[model samples]
Target: MDTKTVTDHLYYPVSAQKMDRGEGVYLYDSGGNRYLDCASATFNLSLGYSHPAVIAAMKDQLDRVVHLTSSYQSDPINGLVQRLVETSPANLTRVHPKVSGGSSANEGAVKMAQHATGKTEVITLFRSHVGQTMMMASMSGNAFRREPFPLLYPGSMQVPDPYCFRCFYGQSKETCGLMCVDRIDDFIEYASSGRVAAVMIEPISGNGGNIVPPDGYMQKLRAFCDEQDIALIFDEIQTGIGRTGHMFAAQHFDVEPDAITTAKGLGGSGAQVAAILTNERLSGLPAHHHSFTYGSNLLAAAAANVTLDIVRQPEFLANVRHTGDYILERLRDMQLRYPAIGDVRGVGLMIGFEMCEPDGKPAVKLTNHLASAAMEHGLILRTSRYGYGNVLKIRPPLILTMTQAEEICDKLENLFMAELAR
Candidate 1:
């Protein structure tokens, strides 16, 4: 009731404008102003806000039962496990749904890899935002994330990501000979504790400038992991559940990882749920080692079941691809008109564009400004990593129609015209 007092007591700052409700891709505020949500409400609304199917399923499940301990085998959990195993890569036959969120799912995968390999270290790509949990924050790419904590998780290291736009090795994709994968040997040799458990990665870097790996990168990485006997884990939390047109990015890239961690978009209309899908080798970890209280809630499982059914539809995924391509093409055209847009990269509906100075340096301030100004154009845009990076992400809901996609581009055009005019 006391809005000012509540706002003052909150740990993190929030916008002055309060949101009332959401539908599909649009969110309405208290004043009834509707704005297109390009960030998909933290990139978790794969089916958009207040999705009918998800709501109906949850409502139905609510009548039957809402809470049951994970010890009991409920229909919702059973269906969710079956659906996940069926949709994930063929190698991922086992599904572990007793994880609370993306962070827990990812940590469980690492624990499985460690238990399987008897190793203690983890290798993640530079700039990757794995999670905010203590362990994940320690393993993630950016230094600023871990700087605040004194006693950080040990035995984790970061290697150069396959960001072709500004290759860390200073070689172009043509003549680079995949130096990024090859050089991991050096990092493992000198930088790690020698006993590396897994190589975790996001197929397309989420919150890391939307950096799509160069061609053959995933395959080469797979081979490298195999050669090293290191478990390969795909952190598909942001890219999974139809965000990438494919059921999983592993399917899109055609390289099966030893394990895949999924969350974020799996709940469709924002139910809190997450799971870790693993092959037989990485499935030996006991449930007690990594289970959470809310891991297998019946209500969340019901929401996930309907979400999976909708996203698994061939037509639904096809529309995501088509719409993504259309938006990418429109952004490329804008890139030519505005020199500030240094690059545009994406797969399916997960897209981002770099804001750069005339000299090709990261335009961090400009990117932040655009995100803040986007609301003026009736659009809600979010910058990568809360403005620590120079990329503006345009990842709308997967259910976006062609007309809505056009509207997004048009609004972006007007935003650029007003802000970036020569």
Candidate 2:
């Protein structure tokens, strides 16, 4: 069949150019055009494309078995569980590897929270994209995502996130005394059902403009949750597995949450796996209550085990921090030259810069246009909130070297020069 026919038969729209293969951080089209993928193939691929270590591990597991029921114990699964607990925060003692992806992991984490707290309400931040599952879609903050579904999750509410650049309370970070955390009291008392079970948040929001919380925000939130007996869940799908220079963002923030949902980068070279890590208190949910058919595949577990081993290395994580700092520095320089570059924020390789109009409104159209034009400059870029937002994400593979980091910044500068020249 022709490529066009195959594409037409598919359920979703795809780019006209056919990507033939991927190696390291570069994806090559059928025409032999190489584009440095800044989005890391949906923000997974911490080890870049076809990583040798992940592939070898999967190959070794494939020789013995690929999929097995989670009811049975296996070497791969046992190794994965042990490694996850060892690498994750000290408080997260249990690992639930029965979830298929980030969505299910997040939903499972919420279920654990609900089960433990005996509460129904879940709170998230504005512009957050927790997932696309029916419950997650409803729970997510953006109105556009939940607009089509007439029946929505009832007890989910959104509070203002710590986006100091465009603060919801119109207060600066310095003198505001962290009103973003303080104001949640009003949200819980008035907007919510009062029996709030969980407050799930991304340490650095995956699609919500990559907003990083203020210095003391997570600690304050932890205290607030403790005060209210609410379970704190970190949706670390996009920020985990060395993406943030740490095994998990929870480690980076130095605040332990009640639970964490991890996926995306866990597969390293894209083997399809996810898991929920929780404290003993939230580990009461039975395996049957939140397990998928494909959840405990031995092949994926093999991949994850190797992925974790490689990512946990101090030198590997240090490289992520160094490369990320270099890119952030370069982007900050770009911000100085480019007035449209409103805000630059990130940690490790997960970075984003918001585009703004001269009047300070979101430059949504401009953001989308640049993402489209990026391919011409040998770059692959993705817009935040699946294009409803004005932030262009710069989360490349964690395996990115200093030279590759420089290349990304140079190409971005060229893209801006060609398109945004005054």
Candidate 3:
């Protein structure tokens, strides 16, 4: 049951050890090794593992039905769709469900945007990662993923994300004047050429190390997209469904995107479900152009409906905000003590720390070592992929308590100290 044995035998060895089960914010290996899951199973599982309510909902729905094609409207699917329409921003009413995952939802969004606008070009941030699909992979900025699949989908362009930590433009966060948004303006001016239909972005970059843009940046970009008659798409795969102390990260900035794609936490650990929320304007597009066979399956819809009901509550979100603030404060204190900690960023429960060498270069090797060490010590973390993999992502489940947060922070602090001493 050692890590070595597990990795050697597992089919796809992404983990140090094979997980036997999970409950709340913890994952246990068959050997009874417990790990505090700060990774949140790749930033999904927002409500954590095996919530009683989510399990009950799934079980109850299983008794009634499992899969129902979108061609026929089932009660669970219809009811869930209606709830999504009602809860989303007024302008965004039309709902398109996809099999649970970020990539499919993004694919749906791209098709909708193109269908609505009759344009081919899609622009996104340079460090952004949409998904692994042929089209989504083309839109992603990760070179490693796209390198193998050469000749990815055409009509995709990359613009600089507003990464204040390592600003594409040489400007500080305080005095930069939100040049990141202005770069989008530049892209619209020179690159758009009336061919660009959509500008997709993460309200907060997820796998790109939870990089949060400055206040007003998202709003300004939304305004720019509106003025240019381009559809604004929010890929909230990691930031939606109350991961960021809000139902959607766009809500935090008060920016209503033309379309928003969400997955991960949509099923509340019950079923696989993802959805694309768009306005009537985009939905009015011919249906034949954009359709999925099993998007609104009955079981997925029921699970999603229950998940949304729990996440959308004002009191629950307020708790998230409160817990997030406490975690951020502790991280800031850690940053002061560790020179390797270059930056601490993100909103709500989605947070990260960028590790750097003493010379200020990205300490990728050290970060990987630290993560391995942390896992050995019963904590799980993630590395980012924005040029360097030194950024440590700390996106735990929303159901995590302050006590759990404290334990995580304390363990991380100990890890940092131990590594530095070594």
Candidate 4:
């Protein structure tokens, strides 16, 4: 490797090229090689790199202030919060800027839920990737990731996700009648002390192969949580910020959650920041209950403010929907040409298509090969398959144009026909 790495990251700058910089939906290396950013630069570059407006905003804020703890108020933070609240679902009236990414926000959300409900347990899906922290890693549905940690979080409970492709109930969606949702009570009663503080779910399981549940899945889960009086927390770190053609994925199902944790794209600038958006009812945490030193960094908040302004516009969201539809349609067409493409799923730009064997099992080897090969062809896609390794994640920047979508499709078509057809 030409560059020094500090962490065990699997994706990004994979090639032995000292990446120079990025612009729009593209990344450039020191060798001047440009690549189409198909994975949105690890699914966080919502505006893509060097977005002029975001850069200008961050620069302007840097002149006024660099950062402040959450205890102090700053204009950038206030503005970002206002924009988030205004653009969020009607029920998400309050927002708390957390001092960490998805995992921290999730942990904070859980604490708030526990505080409000007086319960310590939470119910999470079997495939939902929460975060990298121990508590989150333990709470995650990915058994392979959690297997090493024997002393995992005790209060977290697991339930089958609404994964229709491999439905846990072993029945078709038409006949199963959402047996996944119907079993929550059984799990709660049989698995826990009958006291779950909250139920956290990813509206579209991003790392779990872009698993978009059936139409009524979110609504059904919402009803169940309401009946059970458990806080419904939607982890929108991957699907939020116009990536889903909506401000939030919950809007797609027309179901509002009790809270939503956002990050990844929220910062807009390459800096990391996250927040826990909740309804007013769940905002009773005592002062200093939770805090991160840099959670409310002024620069990140400035970038996020600019990002929200640009992404929340009706025109911007419409473009995301249109471009996503174009890409999805092309991918579906590819499914007919390639037997490897077992499933084409997702909404907006947050998309994935599983590579599969002839017998319909996940083609993990081929999927991994194709993802690596994509870089050789001047494109960057993500194989964010959790442990399954068959889900080739295709989430691109929200700014992707029709031409870029077609180019990606064309590159993929060629990759499949020329390389994988062997």
Candidate 5:
């Protein structure tokens, strides 16, 4: 690709190299150089690249048919919905599919919440990122992503997230009485004016540096929302489908959300599909208010069914928990050895390590430099824009083995030592 072509069209510059193939947990470039796919293409390839089951399902779907525009019903679509409902919380029995990504799923959830309650306002946590679409962008707390789209949407409010690392309230996780949850309730009381439809949250903050709240945070939010008659929406787009060693992150807290949104790993390793799962009370709303043409396409549905089957297995979930624990322990050791590592936090496979300068201020530049350096060492990692962009996100596939986790942790330690010497 030409420089002008690469630079002018895309928001980010496209690297010249092209991916040739992928298998298991590795990807190869056109030159046949293989790299360990720790990033998992933004942490979506849960079953890893080119799984036989997912591929077979898609091929079988192709042999039957591809699109059936929601005007008609297809077996795969029905089967996928049944599988989703069976795997999700008992109350979340209704499903609305979408052909877009996580952004669209968030948009759909917001619309449903509003339609069900006739409320105009919604609440989200500061530093939380829902999606990049117009409505989702408005709900997102990322200033950089929302700067150019100030009037993107209306009736979205932000509150303090339960980020114990750099607590806005100046309290440690041990001493803090979940003032963050109380703050959320206060915000709802003052901001809602009885016009709020939903309070959307990441059960465990995903894009906001994998910030896991204090124990009972989610349960408290659920109880508060119930008392206030506001819907609790869980943006599980990043934390669902066994990424957090559970079918849904809300399961970890044993709290049920009125609505939950999912995408990414839902389709395994192929097709783009997302869904908004709601309870019967929420689903009783008029159907004419929401519909999508390719929402329940047969091909995508088939892939999703297969993906859910694999992720819902007892042995598979056990593997996820085991691997996740190993990774977290290794990260904790790194934090002890490197002063640059400020905090290591997260649950299951979704983890983050905050970076800081010797003087104790967040070091955004150093974090980005480390990510670039890791890429050079054939390990891909993500940098969070939240927490002043000082957190390194490590969300590899749930299928990653213990040996692979050791390799990643060892490389990270070596990289930190080398950078400190420099």
Candidate 6:
């Protein structure tokens, strides 16, 4: 099980040990070393590893049918799509299912918007990560990720993120009046050809430092898009399916987008399910414009259906909100004790804390050091290495308990103290 010799060197220094099994938020290595998964294994396993319900659903589905192309209808398709729509925003009534992964979900979404509007230009926030596919990667805002590639797909434009903590526009949320939204008019007028189809935004920026846009910022974008007749696409590929306490992070903003991309946690426990819930407006895309070979896989759909059934429960979401608030409060307390802890922000289980120096600049080196050190402490912590090497991404499974939450904090406290003290 030597991954280094077998796989690409994308994630360098890959773990030598192989994880044999996972159960209830903890993963056990081949040597029986237990590791607490704080990042939900790339934020995909919403219900934690080997969630009983998710596994049961998958086994049940595999017995009936394992794989089916979307050309023909399947038993779980309608039921899963129905449950998804019921839990999704009211405006998004149509469902386009795709076999797992966020990159595919976002690529399909952007295609639909372009197809429906007969437009060519698209807009995304700086630092917002759309996906890993060629077209989607070109559309992303992180320049570093796309630097080595030769000429990505064009027609994608960038805008300032509503990062109030480290405001890109150098203005405070209180007095700035949401300048990020105000710049769209100029970008479309001067930068674009006016054939803009959609403006894709992360209700909460996932890879972009876990940034939560200021209040009224999201509503402003929605209204502006309406005035301009542009489709608003919310990229909740990382924040959807109970990651943010809400079934979708779009709900937390109290506004709706024309379409929303979902993946990651939709399958409950790393099941392969990704989709784009769209409105009737964007359903005009041609039959084969945004198709996938295994788009409506029954096995993953079965797990996804069960996952949504449990996550969308009112009581389950309530518990998430309660527990998430508790975790946030504890993180804030850590901020008080450790000046290295710069900022804490996020909703529900999708939380992040930025590491900073005493003078308030991002402690990039310290963050990298601490993240690596935590693995030795038997906890796999997701930090800004994926984003920018400053913020720690702390998204546990939706099924995490209070005791597990405390363990995470305590473990991190030691990791931070040891690494940041010197």
Candidate 3, run of 10 with poorest lDDT: 284-293
* TM-score, prediction 6: 0.96
lDDT, candidate 1, 1-422, per-residue tens: 59999999999999999999999999999999999999999999999999999999999999999989999999999999999999999989999999989999999999999999999899998898898899999999888898889999998999999988899989999999999999999999988878998999999999888999888999999999999999999999999999999999999999999999999999998999999999999978877899899999999999999999999999999999999999999999999999999999999999999999999999999999999999999999989876899999988999999999999999999999999994
lDDT of 2 by residue, 1-422 (tens): 99888998999998788889999999999999999999999899999999998999999998999999988899998998999999999999999998899999999999999999999999999978899899999889888898888888788999999999999999999999999999999999888778999999999999888999989999999999999999999999999999999999999999999998999999999989999999999977877788899997799999999999999999999999999999999999999999999999999998999999999999999999999999899999999888989999999999999999999999999999998885
Error of 2 at 94 (Å): 0.4
**All candidates' TM-scores?**
0.99, 0.99, 0.94, 0.95, 0.95, 0.96
TM-score of model 2 (CA atoms): 0.99
Model 4 vs truth, CA RMSD: 2.3
lDDT of 6 by residue, 133-195 (tens): 889889988778899999889898998889898887799889999998998899999998989
Write candidate 5's Cα lDDT for 1-422 as tens digits.
Answer: 88577667888756676889988777888888877777677678878888889999999999999988776678998898898899999899899885467887888888888888888789998888999878888888877878886477889889998888889999987888888888776776677665788999988777777788888888888888888788999999889999888898988778899999998889788567888999976776555566667777788889899999999998898888888888889888877878789998887788888899998898999988888788667677788864258888887777788898888888787788778556
On lDDT, the leading prediction is: 1
Q: Count the backbone clashes (under 3 Å) in each candidate.
A: 0, 0, 1, 0, 0, 1
Worst 10 residues of 5 by lDDT: 284-293
In terms of TM-score, how similar is model 5 to the real structure? 0.95
Question: Which residue segments of model 6 deviate by more than 4 Å?
Answer: 1-13, 385-387
- Of candidate 1, the 10-residue stretch with the lowest lDDT total is 282-291
Candidate 6: pairs in clash: 384-389
lDDT (CA) per prediction: 0.94, 0.93, 0.83, 0.86, 0.83, 0.86
- Candidate 3 at 399: error in angstroms? 0.7
